[model samples]
Target: MAPTNNHRTRCGDTRFPRNVILLLVTIFVFLMAAISIAWLVMHPHDPGFAVTSLSVTNFSLSDSQVRGRYEVGLTITNPNKIITQVVLHRQGSLLLYDSELYSKAAVQTTVNLEKLTNKSVKVDFEVKDQHQKVVPPILGRDLNKGVVNFNVVLKVTVRFEAGIWPSKDELLDVTCKDLDLEFHPKTKGTGNLLGIGKNCSTKNAAGRT
Candidate 1:
């Protein structure tokens, strides 16, 4: 027989320490979870939108169609501290109720919003003979009330900005349901916007029709 060795394995001692490996794996899992939670807590948020002003001109309604010119003023605010939001130039569609009206005729200037800042954006669109003949009877009632409420659907493409890395673009769809805007036929132009009602809400509509 060979001489007995003091600290040597017998022919088949290939097993590892199971307890140490288990501890290492548990630690790694907890570490990764903690990091994920932290990242979520620090994620940036969407910017803010508000209708600042509105002016309506050449307003008319007939048996054929409703023709009008509307000047809309908006304030885009970025409340984030480390992110930037870009509103693409003349890339949004505005709709009134169920009618697919107000097609964009020109290219609007791009707006670059810095962190913790606000920018004013204005858009003018015309309502021509393309409008639907069937008008909601309530339109006249609301107009007479000095408040013409319009449910506007706005869709725009935007991009997020961070440091160094290229940002991907996304679509933001805002549904201004029953946006109660003050209108005065007695006045020469569009009157003051009472305010976008509290019922208005926004949603991200990327990859949608």
Candidate 2:
């Protein structure tokens, strides 16, 4: 009887741990289901961005030094029906030439867009004097061809309000690629966007679009 009692006690101890682990796993699964349900009901969608225009003025590159003024037009749209409003905080824009970062600028103004509404904003970037960055010889060669391809990338913090619930800030990336600027034959310093409009791709910080 003593040996039997000891064996019974060890069996009880092992069962206790198993029971606890099962309870924990059940609770975890329940919480995950609840969160997933809530997320589906909310059905949040990311905003859309498009590059309406890109123009360059006073553009020059001499001795590897570059100076230019870029005016970028962006159209931002909120596509969420449940979300009442979306706010985009201050953001930074990067100008890239041949995948190399040519210049960077900050958008000081915060943008607000209502649901199913779109707004166009102009962002100006000036690279001159101390703000100018050195360019590679390849860039100069490309500029002489009367057309240059560039890319613009934007990093923005976005927040949306759905009814009374205000979401946490999320980092988003907007990439505009293959923007061709055609310079005037007489004035190489002035240029305009080649195509009608370029649509940019957006993704969240987690790499989800």
Best by lDDT: 2
Count of clashing pairs, candidate 1? 1
Give Cα-based local distance difference scores for all models.
0.61, 0.73
TM-scores of the candidates in the order shown: 0.65, 0.70
- Which residue runs does candidate 1 get wrong by more than 4 Å? 1-42, 88-100, 129-131, 195-200, 206-209
lDDT (Cα, tens digit) per residue for candidate 1, span 183-205: 76667346556754333355775
RMSD of each: 8.5, 5.9
- The per-residue C-alpha lDDT of model 1 at residue 26 equals 99
Clashes of each: 1, 0
Error in Å for residue 134 of model 1: 0.5
Please, what are the lDDT tens digits per residue for candidate 2 over residues 165-192? Answer: 4354577888888899999878859989
Question: In model 2, where do residues sit more than 4 Å from their true spots?
Answer: 1-39, 83-96, 102-107, 128-134
